[model samples]
Every structure is written in structure tokens, then in C-alpha cells.
Target: MTTVHGSSYRFIWFGLEMVSLFIHFTCLLPLLIGTPVTRAFMPRLNGATFLGPSNALSPVNVAHSRNRGIFCMRSNEMITVEGVSVVLLAGGVGKRMKADRPKQFIELLGKPVLLHSLEIFSTLPGVNRIVIVLDKSYRQEFSFLQEEDPRIVFADPGKERQDSVFNGFSQTLPDASVVCIHDSARPLVSQSAVLASLRDGSVHGAAVLGVPMKATVKESADGEFVLRTMNRSRLWEIQTPQVIKPDILSEAFALVTEKGLEVTDDVSMVEQVGRPVKLTMGEYTNIKLTTPEDIGVAEGFLRERAEGKL
Candidate 1:
């Protein structure tokens, strides 16, 4: 037997301590870095898109889309978590709207259109933070929101919609597990749709609030000729309040940034990574405030809702 010096014993103990720390960190790094562990457990796209109807919590029928895949729930069981951060995109210049100000600033009822959606999320349960992507020019106009609700903060707008989304998402609370991205233009987005999207996003990693297509959708290859007619039953008119897990969304955005992909919606970012987004059924009433005529339509809807007619 060889006798070891005190220094040798001390050195051996230090090596053991280092090994323990290494093992511990290896196990914790994924959580610390917000790795999407659910990706491994989630169902993958096998050349087909899976869509869940907004009304049905279980798998009843299949809906197809040209954009991305959706996954049906195995059971009606829902998963709920706290710390939801809302990224409300209000950065558009509304050139098509042809208004004096941006459409979001346009009055709907007695207030700006943006306030309708903001008030919904501000009072919503489980929403820990609200990051509004607003241009610096209009920040002063909406300053009262920040004063009223500490959860509300403003993020600067970017060149594109995706860029604006990234800017807003960046301002989300560090503890936020889920992100619900909404369009300020769609002021009539019901609280039920928001909650459904949030719950489904929490369960499926991604969820889009949309209504079934009522009008017959036709595809045109050239500007004049109709190429093909799409099955209306199999289609959905996508809308906002597109909710997604922050980690999954972050990964998708990273890939989009790396590959220079252009996406119109936040769910498209997730789709690029071949992940499934649940189509939570939304209302036709949740219309985007695009043209000047939309303002009157939105006001009518608001009036109906106020009178409990809708």
C-alpha cells in the first residue's frame, strides 16, 4: 500500500468536486437555455398537416392547409401553465387603410382600436406581461396604458411584421413560458379565443386562432385565370392571437433568421421548423381592420356585443 500526502488527497477531492459540478450543469443546461424538450415527445410531420377544429377538443375530423402542419390531441386533456406574455403587434403604417393615422390608432367605439385588444389582455388572467410593438411616435399617445397597468410595456417596431414580432418577444418577461401574439387591428378578438389559443399553445407548443372559411376559396396561378378550387370544409381563415411556447418560438425564429425566411405570421415561424400548430377555432367577427370600411363594421360588432346580440 502506498501512503498519499495531504496535497494528493486534497487534489483528488477537488477533482471529484469538479466532476460533480460538471454532471450537475450538464443536466441543468437544457432548462437554463430554454431547450424545447417537448420537441422530442411531440409528434412529427410525416408529409401531412394535422388540424384541430376550434370547437372540438378531441380528434374528430381532419383539416388541411398549404402553410403548415397541425396535431390533434390524443385526449381531451388540457395542460395549463402560468406566466403568459402577450406580444401585441401594432407596428403597421396601414398604407392600404389610407387613414390619417395608423388603423390601430383609429377610433373604434370611444377609444383607439389598439385599446380594445390591450384592455382584453390587461384584464386577462395568467397574462403576466404585455409587450406592445408600437412606433416611438405613438408611444406618448398610449402612455396612459403603462401607467394603468404595470404589466404593459412598449417595444419599438421593426421593418417587417416578423421583425416587429421579434422585437416585442424580446421584451417578454424572463419567466414567461408561453407567448400570445395578437394583432392590434383585430380588436374584437374574444377572450375565449385568447384563452383557447393560450391553452392549446401550452399543450401543443403552437396554436393559431382562426375561423372556418365560409366563402369558396379559389386559387389563381395567373392574375386572370382560376387554377384550382380549394375544399372549403378543409380550409380555415387564419387569424391572430397566435400563441406559442417561448422556447419553441425562439427556436423557430432563430432558424428563420439563420435561413433568411420570410413569414407573415408567428405560427409560420414555428411551421418552418416542421412543428405542428393547433388551429383553435376563432370567430368571423375577429376581422382584421384593413380598409376604411372595416372601422364601421367593427363598431357595429362592438355595439351588438354591448347589447348582447352577438
Candidate 2:
């Protein structure tokens, strides 16, 4: 009985080896036959021509173009511009927070507010890079808590948000197609809103997140005098994660520099060049943490998200 079982096992092992060899040979056959035919048809073309070899259709040239096209197509398929590189503007003195530390660096749920903002971008699959624009004086403070993640890069904040964005732009990776500039104070920005802005910016040269005004907005000259009642429907409260193409952003900044404009956001800079920035719907919860009350609201928002309520 034992001898019969051993013989059966040996036979099965021999069958498996034969199947493996057949599969290996089948895979190699295509490479062996295709290489010679490809080489015979395709001749190498010079790189100087802007037009690919498909435009010039000799048999040899056609094969060459096909070969190159296959390789180029594979490469392009591999290249993806998923999430945009984010620039977080966090250089303010925090006069509203009234804290020695910048409002961004203030702790919420044991982590700094700025860190929370960065964590959101870091977790996003599309976000490949993050540039934090920090006050130069807080360089040491910012550096102390640095993580080893390659995606995170730091830049010194300029005197204004526009300047900080310029500094951040300078530090952005050359290959990055788009950039999203967000206010560090606004930590409640939703991923959906960010993604929406990116999509809008991709189609339209630029996009900014904004919420329509809920209350009647009035312009007044003094404490008691109301000058004009503005149309609330046309008005929107702008939020961050403002996205734009890298070249467009660069040009906008250059224009700002040339014109000596003191603009608050990249949208304004782009507008200076007569470029219309489209608006993506922004979440009402995405508020800039300027005053003390905002902190409580932010903490509650964070707690809710943590508890799976959001």
C-alpha cells in the first residue's frame, strides 16, 4: 500500500514539472519571433523632428514609430497627476489667537492645527507634495516636529500670503502640474471640496472654493450709517485650496511682482492678468480660525470626525 502511494506522488510531481516547462516555452516564443520582425521593420529615427515617425511612413519608419509609440504609451500610462502639491500659508503673527505661538502651531486634540491641515493633504492619495509656508522666526519651532516623509517640504513665509505662496511655488517640484494653496488656519477643509477644486482647476485654468452669502451683506461708512446693500446672491465667501496650473501661477506671481500689487490670494494675482478664476462650491464648515471662538468650533469638528460622526 505504501509503495503504491509513493509511486502516485512521484508521477504527480513529474506532471507538474512538465506543465511548468510547457508554460515557460510558450511565453518565450512570442519574444523570440517578435524581436527579429520588429528589428527588421523599425529603423532608429533622429530626435530633432517635432513630428513622430508616424508622419513619415516608410515600412522601416512605420515599424520604428510603432515600437517607439508602444514604449511612449507605456510611459505615459505610468505617469499620473493625481493629487496636487499643496502650499499651506501659515505665517501670520496670530494677533487674533493672542497666543505666543502662531495660531497654526496651537494644539488641537494633542496635535498642532497646522499639523492637522498637513495630515489631511498627506493622507490624500493624489497629494504628492506639501509645502508649509511658516514664519521665519518660527523656523526652529517648525523644524523640531518634522516628519521623515519625503512629500513634506518647508518654506519660509513671506511678509504676506501672496509672498508666502511665491516662496512655496519656488520650492514646488518641477514636475508638478498643479498647485493648491490653502490657508493653514482653515483646518476643516473637506477632501471632497479639495477634489472638486482640483477638477474645476484642471478644466478651467484656475479655481477657488467659496460659499454663497447666507446673510444680507451691507457696506457702511460709519458705525450707524449703511451706505449700500449688496446683492447676496452674487456674493460668495472665499475659502482655501485654491488651485491653478503651475505655469499660470508662476505668470500671475510675476505679474504681481511687476505691477507691485498687494493681493491676498493667487486668484487675485491671476485676475490681474485678465484670467477668470472659476469657483467650486465650498463647505460652510471650512472656516478660517482667526479668533478664539473658532478654536472651539474646530475642536468640535475634529472630535466629530474622530468619532465617525462626519
Candidate 3:
């Protein structure tokens, strides 16, 4: 492992500050280039060109552009480890799945989907605490959290997904600096993707997981006719365990509440504030359990992982 010298700490900080200031005023090249991992796929387009010549980003469009894979920033290497807090969201309505209970509570591989998601976060070394948001009625019935670890805790659900998430966020460990928000339906989020979100979120304020789109997308004004074929090159299928700095998460949520804006995901909350958000690549196998067909897919993915074929 590479060690940072005490004498050079100040220098690194100074360099980072200057870079942040420069990027804020002149160019977003630093973030566009991002870390070595992002460079593997992001094309070498001038950052100025990506956001246009305007120094400021348009708030409404920034999140949309970001979701399409524009934001990326390299993280610092020398900061002390301050264990991560994971806010796992398991409070979906599951209306699409037609289940007796929420999809997260439904059986998969002889285990609840929520438990499967919890087990993934448990495998990470830096994860110190997990605040799981469960359906109020189901929490009364489940035995999933019975075999307790000191790190495990539960929070009550809210009327909407965002409320449940913020409730979990408020319960994060006091010492935690990195906060990871994930969907319990996505039980297959990889350990590598979670780690990547942590590293990138540290520098970018927020980092999300997603996969590039492979199929063509079409636009339609009504259900029947296609308006046009949209560009697939700039699109990605977003996923979770979105890791973020606590302060950024707070600020983003505050903005959402103040403006009465509806947000679909955590990183979108950050993006709507006209701030940068990093995107880490996630495997397609990291699917969300939304419909009955998705259950079969999850089984196949789990079987593949078990057989070393994934």
C-alpha cells in the first residue's frame, strides 16, 4: 500500500483546493476525467464541451445530464477511515409484483429479499452500521433480523420512499462520514460496486451505481406511436447502493423538501441542486425485484454466482 507522508498532507490538500476552485470557475475537466476506473469507459471529450461554455450548470438539466454519465471525480487517498453507514430501503409498495407482502419480504432462494440485501452489506469491511427501513406491518412478522449483529438496526417506513430513506439517514451511526443508500429489492449489488461508490462519493460528494444501456430507446407522446428514436450512447440504467457524504445528503434532501420536488433516487437529489455526482459501473445482474418475472431472473443470477459462472 502507498503511504502519504505527513509533510505532504498539506500539499495534497492545497492541490485539491486549487483544483476544486479552478473547476468551479473555469472547467470541470478534473471531474470529467475522474478516477482510473471511470477513465476505462468515459470518452475523452473536453469537460467544457460536455457542460457547454457556461460556467454554471442549469439546475433542471444537470441531473438529467449527470444521469446520462457526465459526472466523475477522483477521490483522495490519505483520509482516515471513518466507517460507513448504510441506509437500506425495503419499504416498497410492491404493487407490480402482486405479492401477499412487499416484494422485499417475499421469499427468494428460501430467504426474504430484504435479508439477501442485508447480507451483501455485511460482507464489506468498511461497513459499520446498517439502518434498514421496513414495512411497518411486515416488521411485526419477520424473523430476518432475529440473529442480530451489533451493526444491525431497523427504522420505521414512511408514506413515500424518500421519507423512509431520510428516516434511515437520521439513524446513521454518529461517527459515520460516508452514508450509503440502497434499495432492498436489489439484492445483488456487488461488493466491488459498493466500494467504488464509497471512494468516488468521498471526492464527488455523491456517487451512484448504474449500467450502460444496451438496447435502443424510443420516445412516444402517447402509448402507441413512436415520436423518435432516442440516443442510447448517453443513457444508462441506474441502480443502487448510492454512497454519499452526510452533509451533501442533508443539503440535497433539504433542497428537495423546500422546493417540494419529487425525486426518484438519492443521487438525483444531489444532481437537482446543480452539484456533481459520480457514477460507478454496476453489473446487470444487480437487478431490482419489481415484477414476478424479475424473481426468476434473480434466481438465475444467484445460481450463476453460486456456480462461479457470474
Candidate 4:
């Protein structure tokens, strides 16, 4: 009996050793075979492919798992499958910007502000196409853009921001599973923030990129007097590239049409339908080109980025 017990222990130890060796082999196999490992990896989940680093996981990925329905937890970085489409909203006339053209048409860093955001999305993997929601009046000015990238297409702007998104969504291919909505005026969006928002959206049905409010808040019934002081801790200033599953966005839009509600942003549509949206942290440098003063700020940010200081 003593001999048999000793043999069993030895067998168990050998099995454990083999398991460790296999795990190590799997990790190093790409290097051993001289295959290049990309910055992103694709993981299969529930018949969908998720692109991200397979080795690391973040707590933020699991933050809404229980309460937000089905959540696919993965690393902070992720790309969707080849069916992702981006809607660049440039329909708004820059009344406040006081520019010669629309804010999006204004030049920043020697390129049009809209082009800066367009370049970012076009280069990302899994972004199959981008729909620029512009007025018919501006189409001739940007006609050369189509020659630059085959994935770009234009959609006519509607009366409101939500309408523009709806028009953009209609232009996406039938196979598109995910939709990313961004403001063309925000020319400084980083690749990291876009990826994080995409991953969060894929996992939690919807996601919005934003930064927490830095200043104390006040609520006013009238412009001159304050009604109450708002809670600064819970306040967040939202930014774009808001991402969502097409089905969820479609449902949100359906509700919007049924109720005739005017929405300021895309994620608010999900909220109206009682859906939760994950908030991904975005940089303060991703500012919208709202007024003339913002141009100087953007130029400085661009300089910092070029010098590797950002």
C-alpha cells in the first residue's frame, strides 16, 4: 500500500509539470516559429470574434457584467470584427465657431478638422467603412476624399444630430454589427480612447467615452440665478466616439421616432430605452473645435504629441 501511494504522487507531479510546459509552449510558439505577433489578438466568444490582448484583463471590463446583461470581459484594448462602421457627424454649421466654413471644414494642423478624425478611424482594423454625414452643399469640397479611401461614403445631414446618426446608420452595410459615432469637430481623438470605447461597447452593448467633471457644478432655473448646486462627483462631460451594437441603436432610434424626442448624443438614445452604457475614460486633450480660441489649444496639443509629451 505504501508503494502504491508513492507511485500515485509521482504520477500527479508529472501531470502538473506537463501542464506547465504546455502553457509556456502556447505563449512562446509564435516566437519560436518566427511568426509576427500583432499588437491585437482575436478571441472567439459566443460566435463573435473579439480583438484584444489575450494575456491581460482589466477590472473595468467586468464592471457591468452582472447589471448590464451579457458582458464579454477582456483586456482594455479591443477591435470588433470586420463589420464595424463609423458615422462621422459633421452636419452642424459652426454658428458659434464664427469660421469661414463649418467647424469640421476648418483647417487644423494643416488638414481639415474632419479629415483628422477620418484618418484615425479609417486606419483602425475591423472598421469596414465610414459614413460622413455632411450637407449636400459641402459634398463638392470633399469629393476628392472618396479617391483617397474606398471605404468612405457620404450621407445627407438631417434636421437634428440624432437624425444625422439615423441617416448615417442607414448608409452602413447590412452586415455591420457595430456602429461607432464620433464628432468630426473633435480632431484630437486618440487611438487608445477609441479602442477602449469599442471594447467596452462590444462587451456591454453600449459605451460612451468621457472625462469626469473637474469644476464645481451649479443648476440654474434662470440664466442669472442658481437654483441649486449640483454634485460634482457624479458629473461627467461626455465625448465621442460612442459605440453600440446595431440592434440596440436601432431599438433606441425606434423609441426616438415613437416619442419624437430630441437627443443631444447617441448614447442618450440607449438611456431612453432603459439600457446601461459603460463609460470609458478619455483624455482631456480630445476637445471639440467649438470656437476660435480652441484652435490655439489644439495646435499646442498637436505640438505636445509630436514631441512625445502627450
> Taking the tens digit of each residue's C-alpha lDDT, what string does model 3 give over 103-159?
988878898888899898876666778888876677766545645677878888887
What TM-scores do the predictions have?
0.76, 0.71, 0.72, 0.77
Query: For this target, which candidate reaches the highest TM-score against the unseen true structure?
Result: 4
Number of the candidate with higher TM-score, 1 or 3: 1
Report how far residue 120 has shifted in candidate 2, in Å.
0.7
Return the clash pairs for model 1, or none. Answer: 50-70, 54-281
lDDT of each: 0.82, 0.74, 0.75, 0.82
Error (Å) of candidate 3 at residue 198 is 1.5
**Residue pairs with clashing backbones, model 3:** none
What's model 3's TM-score?
0.72
lDDT of 4 by residue, 75-128 (tens): 544333446789999999989999888889888779888888898888776777
Candidate numbers, best TM-score first, in rank order: 4, 1, 3, 2
User: What's the TM for model 4?
Assistant: 0.77
lDDT of 2 by residue, 1-310 (tens): 4356888999999999999999887667658777543343333444311112211111111111222221111111212235478888878778988887779988888888988887777766666678888766776776754556777778988777788888998888787768989988889987757656765676678989988889898999896989999999999988898999998998898888898989977899989998889877888889999888889999999899889997
Error in Å for residue 99 of model 3: 1.8
For each candidate, how many residue pairs have backbone atoms clashing (under 3 Å)? Answer: 2, 1, 0, 0
Model 1, residue 96: C-alpha shift (Å): 1.7
Decoy 1 TM-score against native: 0.76
